[model samples]
Each structure stands twice: as structure tokens, then as C-alpha cells.
Target chain A: MPSRDEIFEKVKTTLVDALGLDEDEVNGSSRLKADLGAESIDFLDIVFRLEKNFGIKIPRNELFPESLFTADSGFAENGRVTDKGIAELRTRLPHADKDTIEALAKDPRIENVEDLFTVNMVVNFLTAKLNG
Target chain B: MRWFWIDRFTEFKSGSHATAIKNVTLAEEHLHDHLPGFPVMPASLMLEGMAQTGGILLGESNQFAHIVILAKVPKMTFHSWACPGDSLLYSAKLIQQSDEGGMVEVKAHVGERLVAEGEIVFAHVDDAANGGAKIDQKNFVFQILRNVMDVGKAGNGTGA
Candidate 1:
């Protein structure tokens, strides 16, 4: 298994190459959408690159699972994430930053879900997948 | 008539994807017949162009080891009409593949404007084992395809 630092390096490279972002914008705290300005299509490019580089198969619903925040999903209430949603997100996205998630939970707007996906979150996810 | 649709491949990356070009001209029979004087390219032909782009990517992914055909077009949408003097650019990406068949996504562009986009599925046929004269025609089709895609007779290399 690769070290955590090694995995982060690959993750950073993948994000930079896939999104065509400056190297400085790929830091750990940078959010995929707000900080890096990643659109929905960019997610597919990122996933494709990660799969090719790491030789892993990611389900279409895993990385940026919009289904989890759908109108009928039990995770959200009134277009906002409920306490149940927050807990589920914690379990599902082990790689995401806890601090950012907590800050967003105050309002828990549906769009805030994107804020959970930080650069470090991707690094952590890859590290866990590689090790597991 | 040949099953081929794309005129030439400008870029081919073996397994990943390909970019092909088809020049629309007033000399083509379909353009004149479809409309009285407007002479716009038919949407079906544009879909065929997209399918051809995806089909080539699917076939080359496995080194032409299987006879690939456009099995189904689950979704296709056209945004604009392509007319004479318009050069269509087809960009194809492989979504997934198996021994039996594969799926691909394609987008057609006239210059910077997107003309069409869709996902296409292809199936690998074995006419040789099924025993038909079509088996011989497969060679003809592949020959024409190889010429346009700049593929080798050996079915290896990126055709760069």
C-alpha cells in the first residue's frame, strides 16, 4: 500500500490534470466546486483519470452521489440535510473534512453537500481504497 | 454503398477515444433528396455519423478482434442542422466494454458549436461462425475503416 502522502500526491495530480487547475488550487482544503470551480462534467473526467491511474472501478453513484440528496431521500428534509443526513454523510464520505461538514450543517442547504468534497477528501478516499 | 460514414480520422488514441471528420457537400445524394432547396443534412445521417465514431472506438479498443455494429442508440439529440460546407467533428469516448459488446458516448460539433450528442451501444457479431457471405464483406468494411482510421492490417499500433 502506498503511504498517505503518496496517495495525496497522486490525488493532487489527478485533480490538477483533470480540471486544468493551477497547482496551487489543488491544496488539501480546496473544495472541488466552490474553491476549484468544478462543474458536473469535470467530475466524470476526474473519475476516469482516477480509475485509469489507480486501476479501480468506481460505481457511477459513489463519488458524487446526487441520488443521496434527492427530494425523496430520507437524508434531507425541506431541501436541507437533516441530522440523519449529516450522520449518513459522515459514514459514506470518510474522506471528507469533518470541520467543513460541521460548518455547513448549521444550515445544511442541499447545495452545501458539494462543499464536503475537498481535495483532502479525495486523497483520503484513495488511500482507504488502495489500502483496503 | 459502404457501411462506412466517417470520411477521415484526424486523431485516434487506440483504446481511449478518437476524433473524426465528415465533410458535408452539396454533391451528396441524400442532401439533395431530403429537402427541396434548403438541402440540410438529415438528423438520422448525423446520428449515423456519431454511431460510426463510437463504433470505430469500440472496435479499435479490442484491436478489431470482433465485428462491431451499432446495436442500439439509447439517446440522441441534435441542436443544429449541418449544411454544405460544414465540416462535422465527431468525438467518441468508450464508456464500458465486454466480450459481447460495448457502450460509447459521442458528440458531434460543427466548428465550436455542438451539433449533436448521444450514447451508442455496439455488439460484436461473428458472421464467420454463423456462416454467411457477409463474412467476406467484413474484410471489405474493415479495409475501408482501416484506410480512414489509418489502421494497420495487423490491427496494432495507434495509427498515429
Candidate 2:
């Protein structure tokens, strides 16, 4: 199995190419949308590139869940994510910073779910899949 | 009637999923207008093709009782370029459906390589309920759809 550093390198390269960003823009702490300006369309491009580069098949709702953060998901209340929601997110997003998440917790916009995706989150997800 | 982005449906299942095909050709007028030298199919058009495939599936889900229209594309992304002579296979799976609209997951591929994938949302509008001018050519739309989709295998002889 590749070391975590090697996995991060591959994930970083894929992000740079998929989003057309400079190499320096991608790092462990960089948020995919907030820092990298990745749009809705770019998410598919990123997933596709990752699948091809890693030789894995990512289902439609695994990496970026389709219905997990919706209004009826029980994670959000009045457009804000509840404590229960954050707990659920923590499991799915192991690589995101707790401080960053807490900062955004005051008024989490359900539509801004992409904001929670950091470079490390993807690396972690891929690592888990590879190991499994 | 405007030309459809998808050529025909190779596989279709009502309210579940559908698969269609589109042949990219150099003779297309849109290709000439997209780029002077590069004769590749526009990514936007590929997205439209996905929407068309899903829209048809959604419309048929209710037997065309309402006019289904592409309302929004929450997510759409392209992984590779599709050139002329490439056979584009489009697959759409219905996620949820209601009286108002429906959601679908759509993807496009060339052989084994996935070229594009996204989610398309379509609104089912009851023109009569809204007091809007109804489409007199509903039959025309149905006819064209029938010509493309293999309604016999879909188990809905009426293309529903």
C-alpha cells in the first residue's frame, strides 16, 4: 500500500488538473470550493479524474452524497446544520478541520455543503477505499 | 419541431432508468459554429443530450400528462472531449419523482470511458391547471419520442 504522503500527492495532482488550478493552490488544508473555486460541474470532473487515476469506481452518492444534506436529511434545521448533522459530517469528512467546521457552524448554509470538502478529505476517502 | 440531441433509446425502463445514444458527426452545424478548427462536440451540448434523455424518461413516467421541461442542472461535469464519429451512450436513472417535478442522475460515455456525468431536474407542468396555453402539438412530441424510444420493451405501449 502507498503511504499517506504518496496518496496525498496523487490526490493533489488530480485536483490541480481537474480544476485547472496551479500546483501551489492545492494543499492538505485547501478547501475544494472555498479555496479552489470549484463549481458544481467541476465536482464531476474531479470525481471522474480520481476514478481514472486511481482505477476505482466511485458510486454516484459516495464521495459527494446526493441526498445527505437536503432539507429533510435531519442534519439541517432552518437552513442551519444541527449538532446531529455535524456529527454525521465528521464521520464522512475526516480530513476537514474541526476549527474551520466550527467557524462555519454558526450558520451553516445547506447549499454550501461543498465548502466542507478539503483536499485531505478526498485523500482520506480514497485511502479508505483502497485499503478496503 | 427542433432536432433532439439524442438519436434514440437503446434501453428504457419506466420510472427507473433509460439509456440512449447520440452519434457525433463532423457534419453537424453546431460543430462548425462551436470552433473554427476544433470540430469537437461542445460540452454544453453533451449536457443538453443528458437532459434530453432524462427529460424523456421523466415525461414518460406520467404518460406525458404534463409537459416536462428542464428546470435546473444542479451538477454537470465533463471528464474528456468527444469528437466526431464517436458513439455517445447516455444513461439516466430516475432518483425521485412527484407531481411537480423529478430528479435524475445522468451520465455519458464513449465505449468504456465516461465523458460526462451530472444530475438533471425536470418540472412536470400541467398547463391546464395553470391556465396557460396548452401545447396543441403534444401528439407531435409523442410521435417523435416514440420513434426514438423502444416503447415495446419499456412495457408502456403508450410511452408512459
The candidate maximizing DockQ is: 2
Model 2 Cα lDDT, one tens digit per residue, A25-114: 898988787899886556665776677688887776678764566655799898777888878877766656677677667667765566
The parts of candidate 1 lying over 4 Å away from their true place are B1-52, B55-160
Please give the distance, in angstroms, between residue A90's alpha carbon in candidate 1 and its true position after superposition.
Answer: 1.6
Candidate 2 CAPRI assessment class = incorrect
lDDT of each: 0.78, 0.77
TM-score of every model versus the real structure: 0.54, 0.50
Candidate 1 lDDT over A1-132, as tens digits, reads 899888888888888866667777788888899999887656656766677678897776576665587655789988789998999888887777888788877879888898888888888888878898
- Residue pairs in collision within model 2: none
Candidate 2 Cα deviation (angstroms), residue A19: 20
Summed backbone clashes in each candidate are: 0, 0
Which lDDT tens digits does candidate 2 get at residues B30-127? 88877778888999889888888888888888887767767667668899888889999999999766565677889999999999998776665565
Candidate 1 structure, TM-score to reference: 0.54
CA error at residue B7 for candidate 2, angstroms: 0.8
